[model samples]
Each structure stands twice: as structure tokens, then as C-alpha cells.
Target: MAQSGGEKQGKLDFDESRIDSGIDSYKSISREQDASSDRSQEKEKACVTDERLDSAYVSSSLNVDSLGDIIEQCSISECESATDCEYTEEEVNFLTTVTEDGDTILHLAVIHEEECFARQLIDLFSPELMDIQNNLYQTPLHLATYLNLPSVVKGLVKKRVSLELQDQDGNTPLHVACEQGFWDCANEMIHNASPSKLSCVLEAQNWRGLTCLHVATLRKHHRLMRLLLKNGVDLNLQEGTSGKTALHVAVELHDAPAVNMLLNKGANVDAAMFNGCTALHLAVGRQDATIANLLCQAGADKMIRNMEDETALDLADGNDDILALFPFDDIQIMGRTVMSFS
Candidate 1:
């Protein structure tokens, strides 16, 4: 208590330095604990985040795999049973190619006569694939007609498939049905087609300029020809290249029934080919006396010659009926008449 001024000042300075050092040490220890706690919290947070991410990834992957598996199972089961199975929108949309030639499932189902499968597929994905063309540029209806699947044709018609759709050869469904002798299919098409579409069906020609009637005649489908004629198919419509009528096709094929059908339908027997040879010429060349008589009765000109100046009599190949039927007076009259007309 009785120290000198200098001693007292030195003692006070020592106490202050000791207090400052203790304070610095306390702050350093607190700083170290805070750093350690922060590291632990960061690690815990990282662990939780990693666990959540892993769980989400697994859930997503499982969902995708499950969907894929369901689709594969459904397709396999349906195909094996040869029947259509009920499927949701998501199920039918599963990836499946049906055609061996890159046709869609709908196309294959329709063409192959898989009724159930076609129905199921149509109900699901028809809006998307109904209009899709195959590698041959054929629609589902085209394939259906080609395969002569009446049920499939009816189904497609029920779904309102475009009747005017054409294939690569510019053939409509009616063209195909008629060409393939699918009379019922042609009837279905005729019944469902609109008035404006009727002309297209009647007038649809193939690469050879053969209408539906020509096809029916070529196939000797008399009933189909009658149906087409009843629908107002032009009996005199000539082939574009050969200029041959339905009558000509019948005579060429020697199809007596078809020829009779055409003649009965008012087919012009006298309609000449490009070389001015009538159906009688063809019938006579084939030695078909019955057809020759039928054409003669139908007013076929016997004296008409081809580009080689050979008449049906000359081209008769020694058929006595032709030689006997063509009387000399009638021959002279026909020649004079044809010459006068020419």
C-alpha cells in the first residue's frame, strides 16, 4: 500500500496484461469448438441430402422399369391368345411394331384378321395410326381389302376410315376389293360411300385403265359385275391403253358368263378395239361359236378388219361355224356398209 509511484504503475500494467492474455485464450477455445460444430452440421446435412437423392433416383427408375415390363407382358399375352385384350391408353401406347414390312400394330391387326387385337388397338391408338401408310403406301383399309378380311373391313368402315384414300398405284379400297373379288367388301364400300365418292369408286382405274367392272369381268365374277353395273358403272368405259371395254375383257378371257352378263347389262358388243376389231373377232379367234353367235345377235359387225386388213372371218382359224355363219351376201353387205361408213 505504501509502494512508490513507479512500482504501482508497473504492477497495474502487469495485471492488465494478464487479464488481456486470459481473455484471448478463452476466445481461441470458443472459436475452435464453433468450427468443429459447424463441420459436424455440414456433414449431417450432406448425408441427408445424399440419401434423399438416392431414394428419388431409385423411385424414378423403378417406375420406368415397371411401365416397360407391363407393356411387354401385355403385348405378349395378347398376341399369344390371338385375341384383343383390354388396355388403357398408356398400355396401348407402349412401343410395338406389328408389320413385318414396317407396318404399325393397327395395320397388322387389321390385315391379319386379329379382330380382338385390332379392336383393342383401334380403341387405343387409332386416332394416331389410322392414317399412317405402310411401306407400300397402303392404309389399313387397303391392306384389309387386299387380305379380303370382311370383318376388318367392317371394323374400319365403322371407324370411318377415309374411303377416298389411295395407295401407291392410286387405287382406293373399292378398287382393291373389286380387283380381289371381295364382293361383300365392295358392297360394304358402296353402301358406306357418299354420293360424291361413288363416282370415284365406279371410275377408279388401275394401271391398265381397268375400272372396277373390268376387274370383275376379268375375274369372271358375274355377280360383282352386276352390282357395279347396277351402281351405274359405265358399261362402255374403255381401257386407256387397249381401248377395250368390259365386253372386250370378257371375250378375251372367254368367260361366257361374264360376256353374257355384260351383254345383258347393255354392253356394246360392237365396241371395237384400238384396231377396230370387235368382241366377235376375239370370240371367233378363240373358236367360241356360242360367243360369236351372241355377239352377232348383239349387232357385232363381222366385216371389221384389224390393222392388218384381216377380218374376223379370216382370223377365225378354220372354225366352220364362223365360216358357215358369215354368209357371202351378209359379208358383202357388211363390207360395203363398213366401207361406206368409213
Candidate 2:
């Protein structure tokens, strides 16, 4: 049946509108499919990257174990030379690669106490590799000293590994030895290092502002103290925090024997702190009669005034034992209360 022109025109317009709507829907679906494909590709790429990293990590770890096997098979005693031990390119590369924790092969070897392997690695590797620090900035020498492995220390020293490299706490290998009281390791480092290097190591203050001598005294390591003294450490070297010398530290700790040792070693009895308080001031302040007596006998100035302008006698105002050590005249004049030892 023929329809009227108006009806036909209306039908055509309706048909065109439906066609336009269909095209818009098709375009939306196409855009969605493209976005989905891009997301899938991205996921696949991420997976590939993760797999590579994992594989590399695993490979490097396996190489570390394999290196240990090589060391075992060709023991130091049997191996003609450290360089004679054959290594594959991969194995050699593993020496330079660090673990996630930033420990190189040499660090792991020392931590595991593979002493023989450590010595071999020390000999085989260059100074750069031998001295590579971990995340803690702890060199192999630092670990050897901390672990008290004197032989490993000797190996590192002979190879000229830097003795001055500090850990996270800014402690050099020598500082660690003195703090830990590892006599043999300390001795090895002290004697092997050149005179200039030894002096530098001794002078370096850690983050806590403590030198090797200060640490030894604070820790009450008498033998180590003696070793440091014998090595020519300044008897009156003051610590950074309060300018307290080893003598001041001893008296404050109530260490009679250490006080006597330092005095005999030529420690200045009048060496004052940043506060101008002598060891005697510390002794009297702490009410330590024994140390005060030791300092007095060692010729400590009883009248040395501190930054607070309080003499040892003033700090000892109420203590009769301490007051008795001072001359009657000085106590009467300077002390708040007069007490006569005679």
C-alpha cells in the first residue's frame, strides 16, 4: 500500500536516527575492547619483568653457593695460588653482584666464618671488591674485627683493605675491636697498618664522639687499654662529647684500678673536661672515696675549679672522707663548711 509523503518522510527520519544510534553503540564496544587488550598486554609485560628479576636473583644466589663449593674443592692449602682456582664468567660476575641486602660475596663469606674462603677471596679480589661495604657501610674488615677473627683481619690488613671505613655507627675496624675487646684482632689491625694510617684510625671519632681509647676505658677493657697505651695512644686524648679524657671516664665509673693504671701510664691528673671538672671533681661528685683518694695521691689539684666555679672540696662539702684528703687550710678557705682531717 502506498503511504502518504509525510508518513514516508517520517519513516525515513526514524530509520536514520536508528542507524546513528547503532553506529554509536558499535564505537563504544570497540573502544572497550581496545582498552581491555591494552590492560592484558600490560599485565603480561609486568609478569615477564617480575620473572626476569626473580630468575636473576635466584641465579645469583645459586652462584654464591657454587662458589663455596669451588672453595671447598680447592682448599687454600691445596690451591697453588688464589688465582689458580678456575671460575666461570658467571661465577666471577657473582662476586661483583650484591644480594638484596647489599652484601657482596666477600661479606657473606666472612659472615659465614668461611675463614679459609675469606682469605682466598681477599687474595683473589681487587682492593675495590675486597672493601665493598654492605648496606650498613660495614666493610669486610669491620666484620672481621667484630667477629673477632684475627686471621681474617690479618688477611684484610695484609691486602691493604681500608681499616678506616666506618659502619653505620661510624665505627672503624679498630674502633670495633677496642669496643668488643678483641685483643688479637685489635693487635693485628694496630700492628699491620702503617704509622700514619694507625694514627688516623685512632683519632677518628664515631657518631657517639668516642675514639678507640675512650671506648676501651668506658668498657673497662684493662688489657685493651694497656694495648692502646703501648701503641702510643695519647694518654690525655679527650673525648668529643664533654672533652673527658680516659682518666675522667675511669674516675666517673668508680674504676679504681683503671684510674691507677692511667695515672701510672702518665695520664694528666689535672686534665679537665669541657666543664673544667677534673677527674677529682667527678670522683668527689660521685662520692667515690677510693677514686678520689687515688687521684689525690696521684697529685690531682684539689683546688681546680670547674665551670660551675665549684672546687672539688666544694663538691665534697658534706662528705668528711673527701674533705680529709684536702689540706685543712684550703678546705677552710674554699669549702662552705670547714672540716679538719687532723
Worst 10 residues of 2 by lDDT: 19-28
Expressed as tens digits, the lDDT of each residue in 1-342 for candidate 2 is 224653321110111111111111111111122232334443233222111211211112223223334443433344456665554565566456675556676776676466877887787888888788876787888877777789999988988888888888889999988888899999998898889888988888999889999999999999999999999899888888899999999987889999999999999999999989999999999999899999998898988899999999999868988878876743565557566555
The backbone clash count of each candidate, in order, is 1, 0
Candidate 1: Cα lDDT at 235: 95
TM-score of 2: 0.75
Alpha-carbon local distance difference test for all models? 0.63, 0.73
Alpha carbon deviation, residue 191, candidate 1 (Å): 1.2
Clash pairs detected, candidate 1: 84-116
The global Cα lDDT (0 to 1) of model 2 is 0.73
User: Superposing all C-alpha atoms, what RMSD in Å does each candidate have to the true structure?
Assistant: 28.2, 22.4
Q: How many backbone clashes does candidate 1 have?
A: 1
Which sections of candidate 2 miss by over 4 Å?
Answer: 1-79, 84-91, 330-342
